[model samples]
Target: MKYKVTQETELLNFLLEATSKKRNDLKKALKFNQVLVNGKSESYHAFLLHAGDEVELGKKSRQDLPFPILYEDKEIIVINKPSGLVSEQTMHNKSETAFMIVNGYLKKKKEKAYLVHRLDQDTSGVMMFVKNKKLYEELTHNWNDYVLERSYQAIVEGTIKKDGRIENYLSENKMQKVYVSNKKGKKAITNYHVLKNVKGYTLLDVFIETGRKNQIRVHMSSLGHPIAGDRKYGAQTNPIRRLALHANIFAFEHPFTHKTMTFKTEMPETFYKVTGKIKK
Candidate 1:
């Protein structure tokens, strides 16, 4: 809906009268960039509106999104990325990446997206991207400092009797497979909590202190309980038909604003099915 301001007033006051929406709902709309003033998004409730200003409600929805957008703002965009799509383009494969899909979405607004981090091709759920170069550089350069939480949910092949932590050095080989290396490699630390065990499979809530290439997969494999469907990590089962690892929760501090931001996505229903648990 679009409204032309006939008198000077505050944005929230104008919205309350014009849209007849609850104040909290209108606040949420503004926070999510659903309100625009003369084409630019405005999130401030107290922003002054003058006569002749055009206010628009409702952001344009993208059609056929491979990954569902969880949140977006002027600085960053978050998505619940689906499995099977690579996070970003690589030299060998340049088509149909999450980055490409999001970039296309932003292009309509005359903006661009920059990759802040990546989730593996088969990993589904929360992924974030920066909108501009300055914020992108700020985030990438000090990622460890800004990132507060990185959590995943996985269904592994065996029944874990207890929760534990795995600490080791990991190195990737020429074939792009990660393995524990005692001699020389980057340190990787993973902590796992046993969520449940169903049949022969175990559901794990995995947290990583150090993000390395395939850290969770390697750590779980080291425990002799590789994530289900993770064939490369020595899993004997492919229950979900895809890697049973999902980056379900991600929280970080906004580099520029210094405010904590969090994004979460529901675990895939297939994960629950594989574990014989009802999705809630």
Candidate 2:
């Protein structure tokens, strides 16, 4: 059910006035991720509902969304996020992001979703979100316990002679530049295996046990081989025209079922094309 608000009011009060459902029932629906505000899931009952805002009482039909939904259930959702899109809204850019897009799709169904993690705007591939606040809080509070493995595929400059682990302490300066430090910050661990070598680049399978911001890019650059097209870290080439990194694989146990689940996406076709053109 959908209703367009005519007067400014609080969210809960608006729902009560629009529907005959009791306040408790409306609250239950909101907690279940059933209510939507302007194509997004909003749980704040007292949130002021602006006039003309669309309010959905139940899930609506979502179709032909921009992104692909890899997986979805009552508890969580997984999708293939494209490059050049931020995972969530930032202070500077209030434009559409993965979070807003997902909510837009959900809002069509009168449902809503929550972002559980984020991927850099230039990085593409698998990402996850939670449906309800309870599951969101549970998964966030014990992240590592629930997330079993997270891996990425990166095309980097130069050749990696052998597979190895890169462990270091990473710290960020005031300029937002992250670097490896000898005496500060928290430990970051990245294990990488060389899948193959192309022309002047290496195709690497990177598994990160620690989800540090810019961990993979920093670790690979610290090894003297920045990711291809990663001008921020020091890549000398622009074969792919963007950050040559992707979050390709994610494995985890269900927060509610405790069953192991894995999600994977094919590496961007352009990556293979560029690597193929590199002469050995």
Candidate 3:
């Protein structure tokens, strides 16, 4: 339950191992509330400790992350996550999540895969994870500058007035759920165009230039055309069985191979069924 930091230890990695939270959860614990540094329950970007900083687990702390892999290689892993599975697990939240599942998979394989990206629990689709040490190092080193062409498909309420782009900053308040803001947040951009309109819902082809959390759902909502079945950001409409978002395609240059690689997932059958189109 405890260990002193060594010269060789990465602080965040140490914290995840010590406190049993994923890197992101530890960031939340540090960034949000409840968890503390040196007995003070707050985060200061300047806070630094050398060898000994006690990480006390809150009474409700636990990490049980879970997720599925759509594709994997020596360089990366892609996940076809189902709705209701979290992308990552946390200490304060003991529920199963995609991160916990990935962690378990890696632990069993005795391999370490760095966290590469995220997807919402209710929005099922493709997510990528890096495999092998060298590739992991390369991706993490250049994540902010990563230039993968990531795209999605979603069914939104009604047809969009026009196929276009949405730009904004996204940040969350104390609740930890992401929120779209005109100011005081990270810059996010989403580009979408209608692919089909049926049964009062429009299926759109979406391209995300920036990967802020829930950018697609928020952007669609901002246009008065929320994603179908998005209970959190949109009206509760059961006509659609699940949050109508799908990470259908990911096209990028493999960091190691420098070759363009495109991975695609077939649209869930429910998506077609809900829209009254049964694929032949």
Which numbered prediction scores highest in TM-score against the true structure? 1
Scored by lDDT, model 3 comes in at 0.68
The alpha-carbon deviation from the true structure for residue 272 of candidate 1, after best TM-score superposition, in angstroms, is: 1.5
Candidate 3: tens digits of C-alpha lDDT, residues 143-187: 655557888988888777578988889987776667777688999
Error in Å for residue 89 of model 1:
2.0
In the range 129-223, model 1's lDDT, one tens digit per residue, is 98889988988888999999999999999889898999889999988899999859999999998888898999988999988988999989988
CA RMSD for every model?
A: 14.1, 14.4, 16.2
In model 3, the worst 10-residue window by lDDT is: 59-68
Among residues 3 or more apart in sequence or in different chains, the pairs in candidate 1 whose N, CA or C atoms overlap within 3 Å are none
lDDT of each: 0.85, 0.82, 0.68
Flag regions of model 2 displaced more than 4 Å. Answer: 1-62, 277-280
TM-score each candidate. Answer: 0.76, 0.75, 0.69
Clashes per model (N, Cα, C within 3 A): 0, 3, 9
The pairs that clash in candidate 2 are 59-109, 60-109, 60-110
Output candidate 3 Cα RMSD: 16.2
